[model samples]
Target chain A: MQDALHAALLPQGLHDLLPPDAGHEAVIVERALASITAHGYERVKPPLVEYEAGLLAGVGAADRDRIFRLLDPVTQRTMAVRADLTPQIARIAAVRLAHAPRPLRLAYTGEVLRVVGDQLRPERQFRQVGCELIGSLEPTADAEIIALAAETALGIGITGLTVDLALPTLVPALLEAHGITGAARAELETALDRRDASVLAARGDEVGRMLADLVNLAGPVDSALKQFASLALPASAEPDRARLFAVVAQLRGRVPAVPLTIDPVERRGFEFQTGLSFTLFARGVRGELGRGGRYRVAASNEPAVGVTLFSDSLLRALPPPARTLRVFVPVGGDAAKLREQGWITVAALGPVDDARAEAKRLGCTHVWIDAAVSEIA
Target chain B: MTPPPNLARGDLIVLAVPKGRILDELRPLLRAVGIEPEAAFDDDESRQLRFKTNLPSLEIIRVRSFDVATFVAFGAAQLGVAGNDVLMEFDYGDLYAPLDLGIGACRLSVAEPSDLSQSDDPSRWSHVRVATKYPNITRKHFAARGVTAECVKLNGAIELAPSLGLCQRIVDLVSSGRTLKDNNMVEVERIADVTSRLIVNRTALKTRPEEIGGWVERFREATARNA
Candidate 1:
């Protein structure tokens, strides 16, 4: 009965990380952390549960619903499992890491919960490995994050991937400069989001018409950016547009041969992005491998940028890495000789062929033939 | 698993259903069109994200209302149902909203504390700070009138913003005005009347014209009959 209860009570949206899968995930996560840390990003671990208000204070409503909520019996206050790591990282940057330094680079790897609909075929309980480079308004920060994301994907064996880029500030700035009202702007932007040119045109404003026209513009980055170059941006916004172009130029310079496209009206995950936003997609996968963008400091009017790789998706798209093994064996046996000769060995109590097969299946390149194996063989 | 067979280029059809409110509203429409989802779909308490419909060739995935456009735009889901509000939010270029289901009736509007309505004149304001779920929409709405609106973007509970002093005004969806009245707010402006739309992935429609277009026409007919 106790065993049955334990089996039945396994937490929903949470599961035990089995040996081989767990080891594979751990290796990928460590590699991602090492890559980010090498680029001057410090690693930090945020709490698995945070005060409900702290998590929801500035997060969007849709995201608020996704968090796993509970009441802390001791305090009788609501608490929520961390559904996303970015916000907690933001809070840390705002409160704890405020005095760290200018352009603080931070990286983290953890599990995030989303009570996703069961109809979605992906795992709801999964790991997120990512980095956030805060306090930098430079395009270099954006380029570094994007490059890191691409490199991490390649490291995990995900090929034929492309990064779709969009600027959330571009269209909004244009609407503001054209004297569009807030409500009308929302309406027009919604139209643009839907790509409803007729709805945008119906607004009867030259700016809305121009934005509607721009929403249809899509192509390789160079052509799209060149087309956008012709727009008459205001003096204050010229720098932002220039910065966007500069970011594209830098990405081209650093990762010259990667496929990058500019989707000016792309609105997939712009809900949280304040500047350059991107989503990574592979050839066969239905969803994005990862997504991240620049988020503004909610408290102070400062620029911040970061990216997070959905490690679960990454693993799904790539083969598991090889595991290292050192097997112990009885002395003065075939396995002992194998171990002495630099092969991984364990005291073999079974057939040598079975042991070698098991080792190979577990991604161990070397296998030791123990005394028990010699006795059997 | 195995990426669900790569969606078969043109042989398969995936339908994207917006979870929650619209899912409930769409049940009857789906039944009318002969595409009932599995029983688990009706169990709102279920955690499943994808479900099989009555037809072997068709499947449904329940995602956030805003993601319907994304799913369809990326060809992840060949078809979807989304509110005009959502359609307005992400505006995916590859999606084409051809049919209006006429359900999920609501209006996107600007709301402020009821007391402020007595003295507030929208036309007289030179600048405003607004809390909204739709920043692009909110900023564009204000900018049209030459009013510089500082938008504080909130994902949900835009109504609570006014009471919490997060902002004096909020732009959100108003269905019955009960939420606003309960929060001591009044409608000050309207953004757009919203309804759920039948959106088809353009690439899907182009590739499987008959099969995909046939589903569209069937839904359109069902909508017409219901009307």
Candidate 2:
């Protein structure tokens, strides 16, 4: 086998996160982590690889084959590259954070690999910057996570962003209230996910019809909330509905400034979401910049919620942040002085003409002369 | 249904098609439904992620089977074809799997080593630890029996679980059961018989009902003809 050839062709679902794109992605992640940190979300770095068993512990079957698994030569145990950071975070929270305080807030930024086909618009290797608020079932936690996500997006210059929200709890409650069995619930969710109202109407009972209708409701926050309120749901179903509404209300009261909408039928990405879920979309972007929701412990039944921004997607929708000081340090110039001024200086050793072109290419607003020791504005 | 205002008029209707085995099986089905993808679609060596179909209005994107649900659920692709396995795994609330294409036929089942099957009675078990690709379905299947199933999820090679002592039983899709037989496993319980279904984004279906519904009808007719 040609190792070089294989290396050159780099397998599907893996790619080199090259130069400026890589650098810019790093900067974006730093900013995201800073913002999340300022909100008292601490950071955690999980290993990029874990035992296959540990990695797959609570992950669903559909995602099993998507992981890049290989036998660890040292231990002879099967290991997998991280496909999602959430599970690892959960594992950490279960073990390490068990002794920690309630409502643990932790932030993470890292690469995740999924065995996606080469044809998907999303890259197989993409950066995710997110924060998980664990051990809290409070609706305020849900609202706060979403609010932070909105703020982080704005902080990164992602404007005109629309956050489409949903609740996993409500769907199940509605199914139970309508006497829909587990199997029927699965089928109805499948139907709702596909947006086939005809099928939903055909297969769904009265509750399915109402749930399906709610799943399709999307628009301004107030109207969406009113539509949900008018569902006239029984007392048993009220808590889930109230939690969903509370998250919305909290967002309105706390971060009322952010452009938020209530999408009743906005049944996007419920597979992993256990409670409140949302996807942030900006005008002109083809896909979501970030998406996440509460993830309940399948084993211990603990409550957890977090949001991960596809940094690559966010980068595409947002203009690179304005460069602070574009210092063009000429060849053999005092690199130390530019450092003192805290300028992002680019060192160029080419001819004077090439130096000018380099300055233009680097988008430097000012060039410093090496020999003359003068700054060129 | 009028096209959603968010979508540009000339924007092609991206169809999220699952890659690998299903793509191979779906090629004929796609053609049956009047979609002829570019030659590059057939070339496994191709690096292209998105491809154009013969229809100007339709483009095909090959994604993971799991992502087919996510893509369509989020309305990233207005349409998709995914197995019930993928459908059960994510169970996105907004997607509508209107028509059963009946391709990629298989069953989601609980299997154990043939040796273990002799002593194991699923009905008698109070609690069981199982490794599976489908935790939701597995949990639900066992929960119905009043058995607390501690499921250790694995992405693939579920057949290897029993031998490795990861778990005594595995829940996965059984097609020919060749993979199970090779691993000395036998089906102990059957979950749902699986098949690929034509899935559409609910919003896409509602807002562009006529167009999406027409496609659904076309696929329904195609499946009927095949049947």
**Per-residue lDDT over A249-322 for candidate 1, one digit per residue giving the tens place of the 0 to 100 score:** 88888777667766666664566677778878764455567888888755454578888888777776676656
Candidate 2 chain B weakest lDDT stretch, 10 residues: B1-10
TM-score of each: 0.59, 0.60
lDDT (10s digit) by residue, model 2, range B1-227: 33346546524588998888777788888889899999999999999988877786788889888888888877778889899888877766556776778789999988899998888666678999989877888888789879999999888888898898988998898999899999999987788888898887754554444577678878878888898
- DockQ values of all predictions: 0.05, 0.12
- Highest-scoring model, DockQ: 2
lDDT of 2 by residue, A312-360 (tens): 6887876765555576777777777777877677788665665655676
Off by over 4 Å in 1: A1-19, A57-62, A74-76, A117-122, A175-190, A202-204, A233-237, A298-301, A320-367, A370-377, B1-227
Model 2 bad stretches (over 4 Å): A1-8, A59-62, A117-120, A177-187, A203-205, A234-236, A264-268, A298-300, A320-332, A346-366, A370-377, B1-227
CA lDDT of each candidate?
Answer: 0.75, 0.76
On TM-score, the leading prediction is: 2
Q: lDDT per residue, candidate 1, B1-227, as tens digits?
A: 22346455335577998887777789899999999888998888999988877786788899988888888877888889998887666655557776778899999999999999999978888999999878878888889889988999887878888888888999999999999999999998898899999997754553344577588779878998988
